[model samples]
Target: MHVSALWRHPIKSHGRESIESVELVAGQTMPWDRAWAVTHEATQPSAKDGDWAPCHNFVIGTRTPGLAGLWARLDEGARRVTLRHEALGELTFCPDDAQDQARFLDWIAPLCPANRSRPTGIVSAGARGMTDSAFPSISIMTTASHQAVAAPLGGVLEPERWRGNIWLDGAAPREENDWIGHEVRIGGAVLRVEEPIERCAHTTANPFTGQRDADTLGTLERSFGHQNFGVYARVIEGGTVRVGDKAGRA
Candidate 1:
């Protein structure tokens, strides 16, 4: 199989960015993936900077589906991001800046549900990114498996629904599920496939429209007997992975 696409969510559940290549590090998540997250007014004890926290304490797409509509581009050096949404237009700011965080909360307020926890602030976990899993994980998916799920639902579904980090192009449907406890090599990086990534309400929301238009959880349960769509792997060997790089069991 070969790499097809790569993505990163600089802010947890807030925006997604596509990249042609990325540097993977051992025992760490993809650089800047979920590096920062927007905390809510209801956050208990509050999210402290330079510390990891569970996803529920923040504003996420599951509770506010409209957040899925966001598209983001991150400038790693400057810590700046340009985000766009059909309804909100565009915003450019540095997530680490206090003033910019306020601007971001205001910019995204329209997408967040008033009943849900109101967006309060943004925080970063330093080198330890705040992925849904307690440990750092890189999400891996394949087109064939995506097609398997989409076949029952109709045509090809937008891949962003899964929010995977690395998408492989050639593999049999559900073949990745059998890869647990094994190692997969992509370009120069070697990673151990640890576990299947369970499905969440986030997948039901359309990324472009930010609407709950698909029943991805139902489709997975009915067709695959599990609410899972991809695998979470931890990098064992750090290296560069680029689009079109060959990938296979190591």
Candidate 2:
């Protein structure tokens, strides 16, 4: 199979960006993917040290679906991000700057659920990234599998709801899910597939509209007997992975 698309989320649960390529490191997340995440008031006590914490500790799309509509552009050299949403307009800031963090919080205020703990600030684990998995992982999803789920739902579901790091074409539905413990190669990188990614409520949100328009979890449960949609794996060898590169069990 070949990689049909590549993407990254510079700030966890905040925004997503499309990319042509990225240099991945062994045992590390895709560069700048989920590089920073915001902690809520309730989670600050345990998450303030910039260490890995459970995803629920953060203000995320699962709780605030409106955040899913965000699109982002990154200036890698300058360490600045430009985030845009139909409701919130746009913001460009370096995540490391205190002032910038405040600006981002202010800009995203309208999207956060008022009932949940307020987002206090941003934290970073540097190269480790704050992925949902305790082990640093990259999520790989197939378009065919996406279609398999969408077919019964009118075939209108957007793949963005999955927020996968790499999207492959030419694989049958659920084909990669069987690759657990297998070594796979794409471009110059080698990776080990670890486990299927059991999805959450976040998948129900529409990326373009930022609304929970579908019952993805329920559909997966009824249709597939599980709420899984993608596979998560760790890079075993560091190298450049680019769009359209051949990838599969190696």
Candidate 3:
């Protein structure tokens, strides 16, 4: 198996960016996989009775079709983060301070009016109103799996719909879901694939436009049976990974 692509979402639920390479660290994540997200204090139409929380508080979905177009870049040092959009100005955040968070919230709030219906940051430290499935952090998908999911459609689905942090290519399609609870090595790093990442409504939100689309859920449900497409891993070692880095079952 080989890596065909890689991605990271700086802001948890906002959008995603495809990458040629990335670096991994244990107990943390690829540079920007879940750095930010949107939260809802009250139950959303999708969540039913679940109240919103911070990015740290909940799991966001990547299965949503609308997030397909969002893209981003983190400066070489992983300090400056830039979003790509026409009307919206690019904003940066300091992961270490409230000042940066406030700036990011202000910059993002006005752009996503639909998010207004949901409540803001969670009262808990580092928690947000959004919720995600059972991964401590980070989501991954394979190019072959992506192609498999898109095969039925007679073409490829955009990467944004999957919203993964790392994209592995050349591996058997859907191979990731089967590797849960095992360790795999990629480039110089070793990681333990922990679990299959479940899908959620956040996938419905367009990271670029913030529009909600429900088709993504139905597609995943029909193709994969469960509302899931990827796996979660805890970095066991740190190293640089680049495009074409070989990923093998450990």
Candidate 4:
């Protein structure tokens, strides 16, 4: 198999950025991936304390499909994030600043879905990211598997719905399932496949349009008899991985 694409979401449940290459660290999430998250006013106390909590505590596409429309760009040097939407234009701010946090809240208020807990503050967890899984993980998916899922739906599904870190090609549909508990090498890095990634309401939203246009989770359940899509892997060796690199069992 070969690596087809790489992605990072600097902020959890927000925009995604495509990259040509990325450095992986042992037992860590992808660099800058889910480094910051917007917590709702009603977020649980444990989540408010900068601890990794469930995805429900934050403003996510699952709860507000409109959020999937936003595109995010993180300027690590400037410590700022710029978010843009076709309808909302753009807003840039430093997530670490109180004033900017308030500005961010205001910027996203109109986009928040009705009756959902509103975003109140931005939170960070330093070098460790606030990933969906309690353990640090890098999500991986294959083009074949994606095609299989889309075939039954009679429509193309965007890979963004899976929110995977690595996208591979040349693997059979759902072949990654057999890879659990095994180590795979991609470019110079080695990762141990841990578990299958379950589908969520988040996948129902279209990343490009930010609308609940597809029933991805439902499709998975009906067709596959299970709500699963991708696989989660933990970095076992630190190295660089680039698009087009070979991937195989380590």
Which portions of model 4 show Cα errors greater than 4 Å? none
**Each model's TM-score?**
0.98, 0.98, 0.72, 0.96
Reference-based TM-score, model 1: 0.98
TM-score of 2: 0.98
RMSD of 3: 5.6
* Per-residue accuracy of model 1 over 1-250 as CA lDDT, tens digit each: 9999999999888789999999999999999999888888877674665577888888888899998899999998999989999999999999899999999888998897868879988888777788888888999999999999998888758989999999999899999999999999998899999999998899999899899999999999999788998999999999999999999999
Task: Write the residue-wise lDDT of candidate 2 on 62-118 in tens digits.
Answer: 888998899889898999999999998899998889999899889989998879888
Candidate 3 local Cα displacement, residue 120, angstroms: 4.6
* lDDT (Cα, tens digit) per residue for candidate 4, span 14-109: 788888999899988999999998898788888877777888888888788888877789898998889888778899999889999988888888
The C-alpha local distance difference test score for the whole of candidate 1 amounts to 0.91
lDDT of 3 by residue, 1-250 (tens): 6676777666565556778767777766676555555445543344322333333333233332233345677664655566655446565555444676566556655454464343354121122212254334556688787777666655645666667767777778778877888888888788888888776666555555656643556677888787777887877887888878888876
Q: lDDT, candidate 2, residue 7?
A: 94
Between candidates 1 and 4, the TM-score winner: 1
Decide which is better by TM-score, 3 or 4.
4
Compute the lDDT for candidate 4: 0.88
